[model samples]
Target: GESVGLHLPTLSVQEGDNSIINCAYSNSASDYFIWYKQESGKGPQFIIDIRSNMDKRQGQRVTVLLNKTVKHLSLQIAATQPGDSAVYFCAAEGNGGADGLTFGKGTHLIIQP
Candidate 1:
């Protein structure tokens, strides 16, 4: 079965610094990618997304980059803050629908003082 996974389980970034989170997907047919931020005891929140046709997309203070050739995805968060600490996940969908989405294990983003 196709699955998505993160290269690292945790990432620590200093306050006001930029943070980059990486993910890898096994489904080569996936056409859509999404980045989600999950706070403790809450549902994942949508951060940003990118389509297969586009190499990169930006939203607010976040950026999502997709590399189809390597089946890789990345999320960049600008200006790390205390509120930015959470578990970030990368999800992939092959059929352009949420039903077919596969989510990664998630990477814990820690904001350091």
Candidate 2:
């Protein structure tokens, strides 16, 4: 079973298609969530973020959806290209005034040619 704040594993998609990734957070009080994409050797780059108050957010080619009830979150990629292939993860922060954000492990996104 998926626990709150638990990380999802990986997702594989073909080039030019859409890909969806999922996440879950433990903190009901968490008001902020961020999505990151990390490449082979580089650091994780910010993709997008959403506030708990909002059910969803959209970026250039990405969209993030949040479900507070289930403590679930998801990231959607439009026209997934090879460049979008990377390890993706989600981080969450609450009103606790914590120093660092709580994050999921990561999901390896593979772009099949």
Please name the candidate that would achieve the greatest lDDT relative to the true structure. 1
Q: Which residues of candidate 1, in runs, are more than 4 Å off?
A: 96-99
RMSD (CA, Å), candidate 1 to true, equals: 1.2
Q: For residues 17-100, could you state the per-residue lDDT of candidate 1 as single tens digits?
A: 999999999978888889999999999999998989999998888989889999999999999899999999999998657467
lDDT of 2 by residue, 1-99 (tens): 122343557678889999989888876778888999999899989999999899999999999999999889999999999999889988887655454
Q: What range of 10 consecutive residues in model 2 has the weakest lDDT sum?
A: 1-10
Which residue pairs of candidate 1 clash? none
Query: Candidate 1 at residue 65, lDDT?
Result: 85
Residue pairs in clash, model 2: 5-24, 5-25, 5-26
User: What ranges in model 2 sit over 4 Å off?
Assistant: 1-8
Compared to the true structure, candidate 2 yields what TM-score? 0.90
